[model samples]
Target: MGSSARVTEPQPLPWRTTRVVLWGIGLWAVALVVTLAVPALHTGDRSWWPWCCVAGIVLGLLGYSYVRRGRGNASDA
Candidate 1:
């Protein structure tokens, strides 16, 4: 009797995750900018918009970096 090993194929990259994060960040940034530019829309809370925009930018960059790193590791493997 002979024993055989079964091989499985590698999974494909998750582009949806990357796209979602990118779009989420983009939308948030746009909203933040609009809110900041229009004082009437903010209803007297002006400071929050700038902070939100900055935070969104940082989060977006981090998400993008993570996705790229995952892709690099997958390719290396």
Candidate 2:
């Protein structure tokens, strides 16, 4: 007998989506703070890390707003 091949689709829930975004925001916030406090962490390069922090904060806020606006969108599906 041949084994049956089951076709399964993974579900993406609203909480999970929100959690992922929040985690990203949290990580970026931490990195930004660390980079600001510890200049040596950038290996004497002032340009890249600081800019990354700014970008991270901006993108994190954008993602947070998107997540807030899209609450329950996944569960409705």
Candidate 3:
């Protein structure tokens, strides 16, 4: 409520975000395979699990591309 409010610049991430996204996508893929290969995992209550993994992969790809294009705070340095 005062004019003394200070806005600090965002600090850049110290690690590679694209790599992190790829790792997450890889883990999701592994989970998807596990859910498919294990009969009990994809049954009634959990049938939507595989689709979640697929979504993760799709979103991760989008994020990876965005970071690769220098659109995010992730530094390629």
Candidate 4:
């Protein structure tokens, strides 16, 4: 006898992808601002902190553009 089972796919998100990416970029920007404004945050080895935030913002922008072009998702089989 063969077992009977069914598989279900997850639902897609309701929010737009660009909004999510923007939120991440905004957070990174805030972090960069705080890092720059507070001397203690980047006084020594941590001086590279601001760059991390900048990278996040830049990558988020790239992802936003990729999604906007509708090429972010893979083709369904």
C-alpha local distance difference test of each model = 0.76, 0.77, 0.84, 0.86
Q: Which is the winner by TM-score between candidate 2 and candidate 3?
A: 3
After superposition of all CA atoms, the RMSD between model 3 and the true structure is 3.7
Rank candidates by lDDT, best first. Answer: 4, 3, 2, 1
TM-score of each: 0.57, 0.67, 0.73, 0.83
Q: Order of all candidates by TM-score, from best down to worst? A: 4, 3, 2, 1
| Top of the candidates by lDDT | 4
Q: Pairing residues by index, what is the TM-score of model 3?
A: 0.73
Candidate 3, residue 60: how far the Cα is off, in Å: 0.7
Residue-level lDDT tens digits of model 2 in 1-77: 59899979986554566677778878888988898788686666575896797798788788778777875355566
lDDT of 4 by residue, 1-77 (tens): 58778778888888777788889989999999999999988879898898898999899899989987878765442
Can you tell me which runs of candidate 1 are displaced by over 4 Å? 1-15, 41-45, 71-77
Model 3 CA deviation exceeding 4 Å by range: 1-14, 74-77
Kindly list the per-residue Cα lDDT of model 3 for residues 1-77, writing each as its tens digit: 75998899998667687788889889988988998999898889988988988898898888888877888763435
lDDT of 1 by residue, 1-77 (tens): 47687778988766666687788888878988787788776666565666777788898888788886686344667
Whole-structure CA lDDT of model 2: 0.77
Off by over 4 Å in 4: 1-3, 74-77
RMSD, one per candidate, in order = 6.6, 3.4, 3.7, 2.4
